[model samples]
Target: MRHTKLGRTDIDVSQICLGTMTWGSQNTQDEAFAQMDYALDHGVNFFDTAELYPTTPLSAETYTLTESIIGNWIATGGKRDKIVLATKIAGSGRPYIREGQPITAKAVHQAVDASLARLKTDYIDLFQIHWPNRGHYHFRQAWNYDPTKQDRSTAVSDMAEKLEALGECVKAGKIRAIGLSNETTWGTQKFLSLAEERGLPRVATVQNEYNLLYRTHDLDMAELSYHEDVGLLAYSPLAGGILSGKYLDGRKPAGSRGTINGDIGGRLAPQQQAPTQAYVDLAHAHGIDPSALAIAFCLTRPFMAAAIIGATTMEQLKVNIGAADIVLSDEILKEIARIHRDYPMPI
Candidate 1:
């Protein structure tokens, strides 16, 4: 597996960061262990999970189950040092988490400590905020993303408080680096500015959804990544299995993400089918798995630090991990560009 320095930091991570959102829900403990062991054996050293995981059926009851499952693996086999652990503290979506509170100093400190306890580790390699407390355009919110309602002064103040708390965690040796998820270009810049001014831990990465169907991070985010040194940890590189052509023609396989989450949090829009088909056809024409095509494309991006991938079964895991070495030719990339122009933002 290919590896790179995470953002401007000295820490090195694999190009394919194993995503663990389906564990403890779609999969069992033994399955998660198998996936982790296989990933580590294959030199995939980075893994990404979140407090709000097993997300197809995200509920208060399933909260922390995924992290607890990883904790079980670490507690049993003692494979902690074999991987770089990255997880997030959820923000403002579930009532059970801090009563659906915003990110603040008290909230951040409390969240990190709880995560450490659950992961059975003394310190996390990278800790991230699942989303900004104020709001963002991710998760198909761009159509009605009205930032005018958000108070800028209040948001900046909250960021400052959270940075202070993160700084304390760094000093206490509880977390090595900090990151953001589901955040916008503006939010990332603001957090970095505050960290620089306040002597807090620098934001090293931003995990967001990036795939063949969704290219939101290609421009503004790419610019921020190049200039500010905060590269993207691209999630959903297969577009929640849409690029695999499995969900096309209304064929929802049993136990798939589309079957469970129903369009993947509004990602399956009314106009998404044609573009999905085009990409799948392109993958077939080149004699490769559609899923691998999508993931390999993510690895080719200039600002992609890592492509986060998940699987409910071992076969899916191998298919994603295999993309690390499959470099798409310029002919394929040019064809992809033509498809993108013909149908942009199909989701």
Candidate 2:
């Protein structure tokens, strides 16, 4: 696996981050262990998880089970020092998490302690806020997104408070770096500017949904990433498995993400299917696995730091990992661009 510097941090992480959202849902503990073992054996040293995970059918009961699985792995003599671990504290949305409260200094401290205890680790390599306290355009909300109602001064103060809390975590040796997820360009810039001004923790990375089907980051966010050194930890690079072409022929394979979550979190709308099919066809025409092609595309982007990949089975894990080695030619890229132009923002 290829490694890159995580922002300006001394630590280097694998270009392909092992995503663990499926651990306690679609997969058992043994399956999760096997996937981690295989990934580590294949040189994947970066793992991403969240406080609210195992999210195939997100519920309060299964919350944090994914982290517990990783904690078990760590307990079983897993080499924690060899990997750069990244996890998130969920934002104010889920009722189970702090009564859906916005992230505050107390919330940050509590979240760090909880995540540390669950992960069986003293310090997290990278700790992130799952989303902005206000709201985000992710999860297929871009179409109706409106930033006109935001209160800039209040938002900046909230960011400052969060950074101060992160600063405390840094001094306590509980977290090495801080990151953001489901954030906008303005939000990222504000956080970075605040950190620089107040001498607090700098935002290191931005995790967002970037895939063949979602290219919103290609415009402003890409520029921010390139210039500010806040690399993108791209999640859903396969558009929630739509780019794999498994759901194209109107066949929902048993136990697939779609099978569990019918709408694929609003990603499999009717408009998106045609473009997804085209990309799948392009991969087949080029003699490459569609999943591998989709992942390889994320790696080739100049602003991408790592592509977060999740799989329910070892077979899927193996196929996804091989994407790190699949080098797409100019011909393949041109074909991809053509498809993107023909159908932009299908979902």
Candidate 3:
């Protein structure tokens, strides 16, 4: 497992960060523990979870269950020091959490404290904002992402307030670093500027959807990552298993993500099929597993810090962890480029 420095921070994380959103819902506590154990044994030191997890069918009942599962695992042993734990505080929009209120200074402090207690840890290595209060193009909102109505001045003020609260958390030793998720270039830059001006915690990373079907981050966000040193935590590197070709031909396997969350949040567009099949065929032609091919391709991105991978089964987990070692050859990369050009932005 290759490792890299997390942004400008001294902490080093594995190339494959274990994603744990399926726990406490699709999986049991024992299953999550086994996955964590296997990941750590296989050199995956970084784990990413969220407050609003088990999200195949997110509900008020399962809220925070994933965090508690991790906390339970931590309590069972002393492996916390060996792992670089990262989790997110969900932004406004869910009524169960603070009545779906937008993130504020008070909210920042409150969320971090609650997460700390839930994780049963002294501090979190990376704490991220799940999404912007004034949303942008993420979670399939790109087609109609009109940001003209967002109040720029108010947004900046909110960022400053959140930064101030995060600074306090840093001082109190609650969180070591801060990051963003489902955020835009403008929002990331604003947070970075505010942190620099106010001597607050710097933005270390940005978690966003990055897959063959959705390459939105490969454009301007790539440039921001290069110049700003904020690393990209690429999630859905398999495009919700679409790149794996399991959902092709309109086949939804029992208990699969597609079967649970129909169409994967509108990713299964009519145009996505041909490209998905093309990538899968390309992988098979090269004697490579399609899922590994997709994940290895993500690891090749210059700005990628880690490709967040999640699996419902142990076999899937093993294959995903093995992807960290599967170096994509130039031939495979060229084929990928051709396929991507033929079906760019199919999702």
Candidate 4:
């Protein structure tokens, strides 16, 4: 329920952002509605979704179903102005979206219009690029990541074009703020510099995966956010439910994220299970719920604007929302740092 300013903007969002990727895939519309209603009641005023949502299998058929569910909620008497809605435009390399075309000015215009239509909202509070067109390391691609092949000129030009399109959307009142997702420090800085030079929309936030098992944002991204006024909207604070310890001891626990997407997008490496077990044991030893511990850690980070959380059930939603009140002690934080050092980047 704690609120913080989103970047340099005057808008204040909850410390915990309700993530809606499971709306149409793992959860029904009623379940999604229940989660949203509960979150709003608990003072969560921020929600994050993407065009390519309900991503258990990420099929073309269910591509925009999540947005449609939100649209239905708005159509059925849900107050649109009560929450700060954030959505993403998927980047290149997805066959279902624009035939895997790289994001261009025309693509941005089309994507923003489509998202607005689907969300049944005149303007989005925050609009983000789901990923970079010329990608860097993200989604477990770090091991094989190579940045030497990137064309700097083309990347800058693409950012400029995208910003121009975003400016148009702002003028048209389609979106209020702009953000980036799955982006690196260099990319974020470039976008900010471009926006400043051109007087376009300023990049307000960066959504990246940050959890007990994955702390990629702790390095350069953290420093960039601290100095640049761009905040971190951390997704997967539970490491796709790995830090919750439900999948440990060879138990799938039916309907879990692991059961749906077997590997959890390469997060279940052989070396990761033992580390996850240790964290689970630590949580139990301290009489704390693992999910609460993981989420609390995210909230305590210096540069974190909000921790984006998703749950398939009302019970899970309740547990995650309760994390907003769990404060991690200095001793516990030291212990966590030790564990992180012992097993860094297991996935």
Instruction: List, residue by residue over 26-82, the lDDT tens digit for candidate 4.
Output: 999998988888999999999999999989868899999999999888878568989
Estimate, for each residue in 1-347, the C-alpha lDDT of model 1 and write its tens digit: 88998877888999999999999889999999999999999989999998888786888888899999999999998999888999998898689988987877888888898899889999999999999989999888999999998997798898888888888998999999999999999999999999888777899999999998899999899999999999899999988888888888888899999888987888776677898888889999999899999999999998999999999989999999999989899999999999999988887
User: How are the candidates ranked when ordered by lDDT, highest leading?
Assistant: 2, 3, 4, 1
lDDT of 3 by residue, 1-347 (tens): 89998999998999999999999989999999999999999999999999999897899999999999999999997899999999988899999998999999888888899999999999999999999888889988988989998987798998888889888998998899999999999999999999988889999999999999999998899999999999999999998988899988989899999988888988877888999999999989988899999999999999999999999999999989999889898998998899888888898
Q: Using alpha carbons, what is the TM-score of model 1?
A: 0.98
Candidate 2: segments with Cα more than 4 A from true spot: none
Which tens-of-lDDT digit does each residue in 279-304 have in candidate 2?
98888998999999999999999999
How high is the CA lDDT of each candidate model? 0.91, 0.93, 0.93, 0.91
Poorest stretch of ten by lDDT in candidate 3:
262-271
* Model 4 clash tally, residue pairs: 0
Candidate 3: regions farther than 4 A off: none
Model 1 lDDT at residue 223: 98
How well does model 1 score by local distance difference test?
0.91
